[model samples]
Target: MGTMAELFAGLLEGVSEAVAESTSLQGNHLLELAVPDDAWRQVLCVTYRLERRADVPANSFRLSAQASTPLPFLVQVMTEDQQLINQVDFNGGPPAAAISGSLTSYNGQILHIRMSLDGNPLVFHLDLGQPASAALSGRLLAFTLASRPLPATPENEQWPRSVTRQAFVLGYEDPVTGQITPPCRTMPPALSSSRVRQAFLDLTNLGIRSPKVFPLLSVPTDGAAAQAFRDALGNVDTDAVVAEMHQGRQLTATRTGSGAYTFRFVPDARYTGPRLLLVETYQLTSVPLSYGPGRVIKTFTLLPGERTTMRVSSYRRSSQSIQSTSSVLDSTSDESEREFEQAVTAEQGNSAESSKSFEYNAQASASAKGSWGWGSASASVSGGISGSNSSARQEFAKNLTSAVGKNAARASARREVTVDTSMDMKLEEGEESAVERTIENINTSRTLNFLFRQMNQEYAAVLHLVDVRVAFFSGHSESREEVPLAELDSLLDRVLNVPRTAEVRRQILDLVGATRDLTGNTHPGFVRTQAPDGTELAPAVDPTYTSDYTTPDGRTITLPGIVTAAERHVMRTDGVTVDAFLGEGQGLDAYSTGLQEQALRAQAADNLLKEREADRLQIALEIARDGDQKRAEAFRTLFMPTQIVNQIDHAAVNTAPVNGKPSS
Candidate 1:
């Protein structure tokens, strides 16, 4: 009865064959099937031939199927004892049977069959159509039981379908190496619902029946490439290999009947040398249609019971080889270093050249000097005589003795001297012109005034020997040895032992106090004093007493007791007049009155000058204030257009002459 039903179902199979042959299922493809009878079984068969075409890459094609019928009355291909064998279906109007098993006799094609009913057993079979490679053979077996049935009705009649997906084991023999390379198998979609129970059942069936030939491809095993495949798998088992070609790295393994069997490999081909091999698989399941802002798409990933594939190709590292290609880097660095050194040397050479030029100019100017020479022989003799005191005096005396004789001689000599001096002056002027031309490059005021100030300050402590005063003295008659008043001991005692002036003492005390504030000590040694040379000034003697002394300008200065009492006096005695006729008091009174009058006149002049200056300033200030007021008025007038309009309106209102009512 099952065989007849199978035949009848096969005859009633729809045109899905043409659809499957033409269209490729990428994600989930939806199809609807009708059950003529509620109790009748419906079977679906999906067979696909996976071919390696020159255009299509490896592991590019796959096949899977599903049904939308109840499970109990499902039309399927199974045995009478409820054990699935080949192709069969339940009694229905046409006994719809799907011929969906393996297309390739070996592992080259895949077939997936699904049965939908309230309660039904799915059956499947394969037709290679032609003899296939012996290495490409696979089998279909059933081990897991189908799910139990539930009550069904016309409204809720459909039951999730059962599917059987099979992957054929196809192989090819290398002509040279004589090693067989297994054919690629399509991967299965990760199963989410129990409707795909038949698909996994199919896989286990094939694996158990033919453990040696069936291959499970999985992600690559190499640590580097494995992550990529694992990521591709997403949430799938990374350690398991699903399916692969024969001559490839083990991707995943499965225990069929007893022992574990490899299901896939990385490189699918066995090569004497090296070759790239790829194994691919995929999983198909009904994914809920997801809707976003604008579009809807069916998303999928490599999952268990789903189809996935892996590929391996020949590879080599080129980074290291490329790095080693350039060997002259050190030589390039050395050349760069040499260039840098040359640049530095050139800069230094230029600097030295500039310095040398300045030095050469300075030396050339220093080698030249300006000088003046005596003009005439008489002038030279006079200068010599003037330099000798006795000759100068004798000459003056002789001239005084013969005044007329000297005057006549002088007149004649003056004429000759004037002529000779004029000629000699011309000669000297010519010499001076030559000297000016020679020494024209010299800097006359190159020394800055600030630099002179610094030099003076620096040398203030150095006393010139010529400026030092020496005192001469004789000892008492009782003493046999003559004593020099300017002895070194006496000089040291007078100069060094002298007490500081009151001002100096106050400065010292202030310095000491400042030092103590900073260093927490009042010791004199801690006080810092500076000399002209920026050196610390050491006290020549201990500070014993402080006194004040007047400066040379008669300011009534004060100093310590040890300060010398040397009053500075100018020679005003020569200017003192001898008024022998006037009494002392009268002379003094006259001088005082004269000084007072002069002072009063000077004060009056100063007051008049100040008054005139004030008047001038006041006039200028008044003129400026008037000008400012005029400018301010002009500015106001310039910006008073609105104000003028308002004023016109006021005038028009106030000065409006009544047209007919005005009377005197």
Candidate 2:
């Protein structure tokens, strides 16, 4: 039983060897004949002239084989543990074959091959760059191997197992040297065309296209060179349009230094028409730098249906340093004079710093103002002391004060004045020239000088009074003290009242007369007095009445009517002063009696009106019935009897007291 088991095992091994050799013959094989110790896994294909053998079908042969199904020719190299290292494939057709054209060997060694058609095994040997006596021999054994049948025993009732092939090494070299590198004994694993197609699909989904998916190289940040490179990107037609089957379209591109940028394209269904995407790039420079006078650098990218962000930055340089240098030199002396020079230099340095700071602020302010259509102007003056011991504060104050004064004076002197001149001329000839008339008209209308003269006089008076008041008040001393109310009132009264202001009083009276004149008959009773200025003066009276009193009989009386005529007469004259006096005459008495009679009549009428209307009605009826006769009778009854009696008594007294002439 032991020999039988051994014989079976040997038979199976022989079949496996034959199967392996047959598969190698059908596939394109890679042979690792030799390798240096330090060599990495680098493979190369070398072509050489193959020497033809006389009896081997001209060193090339074609064989035709048939299988139940179309079969692929696969070749692989692996270890005994089934870890595959290399693989290759050949077209499974009798005519599609790889011809061996080279007799390449491992290192400087040669290989020997023998072939037989009688089903006998072929043998090969490798020299390994060593002596021929020390060469290794490999047998190409052959036997038909069939799939093992299932065992009937329950313990062995399993499916057939796949056999794992092992890789054979022709020779090896020292690990320390790279010389004598050899071809791989087994083919590398075949790359799937399906896998390559799937990789390409993934890239397409990522919006990668030809020319758009190129690798980006890193660059430097030197300003000009970087700008040049960016400009060049605009001229490059490296962008490609990619359409996705599922997702929307997109554009992918890479810059030299920066990373990749992807732009989404509008979907085909939604796209109305063709569209292009434009991209631009710019470099933002440091604050100290500026773009040239009128030139700016920009980069642009144009693509179809894509969105991209362009970095744009402008550059500018500060003018502070140059401006400061020029300003400092122009404003100062060149010669050094003792410590003063040092102090001046230090001051100039500080000024320069301050100016630079101010310039920045001014620029900002100016920019804002410019946008708003407004502008601003500013000037500053700084002064420094010659001695180090002097305080800067004191010098600054002095300078500020002087500057203010100078500016104020300049403004005052620069006052805008409009002047007019006029000339008056008699006609020197028969007819006046138009030019002469115009000149005359201009001269006649020249009133500015007069107005200015008047204004100057008034201004001088005001200033003189102000000065006097200021002096009297003792330089604002009075401002610190609070005056008593009574004292203030007295001062106001003194300022307001003046006894010698008779002329002013006369003028005021004249104004009152004129106002009364304008009021017409409403002021008919106003009497005008003649003043020394030949002006007629009238007593001031308020034309507007506050209240009116009515009698019981409905007779209205105003306050002005309340004053007696005697009182008005007293007011009109100055205590009966003599003017071209003749004597104290009866004329005044007659006038007085006449005035009194008129007053009596008016009073009587007013009294009668105050009585009951019934009484007035009865009297009026009686008078109307008897006509003038009844009125005469009533008057006689009330006055004639008394007067008649007085006259009779006077006659009797005259008759009794007088002699014979008295009776006459």
Per TM-score, the best of the predicted structures is 1
lDDT of 1 at 28: 9
Query: How many clashes does each candidate structure show, in the order listed?
Result: 86, 24
- lDDT digits (tens) for residues 400-435 of candidate 2: 223223322332222222212222223335432322
For each candidate, what is the lDDT?
0.25, 0.23
User: For model 1, how does the per-residue alpha-carbon lDDT over 1-664 read when each residue is reduced to its tens digit?
Assistant: 1243344335535335321111111110000111112212112322223233343222221222222323224333332234332344434333333333443333322233334433433333322322222212242221112221111111111212233211111222333444433222222211112212333333443322122222333323455444444333343332333322222332333221111222333332121211000000111111111111111111112221222221111111132222222111111122222222223223333443222222112112222110000011121211232223223222322322232122223222211101111112244332212111111112121211100000000000000001011211111001111112123233223222134222223322332222111112233332234554888553322233333333332233222222211211111000111111111222236676688679889999999999987886676577577888665545445544342234644642222224545432
- The runs of at least 3 residues in candidate 1 whose Cα sits more than 4 Å from the true structure, single-residue gaps closed, are 1-85, 88-108, 112-140, 143-145, 148-619, 627-664
The top-ranked prediction according to lDDT is 1
Question: Which 10-residue span in candidate 2 carries the lowest summed lDDT?
Answer: 457-466
TM-score of 2: 0.12
Q: How much is 598 displaced in model 1, in angstroms? A: 36
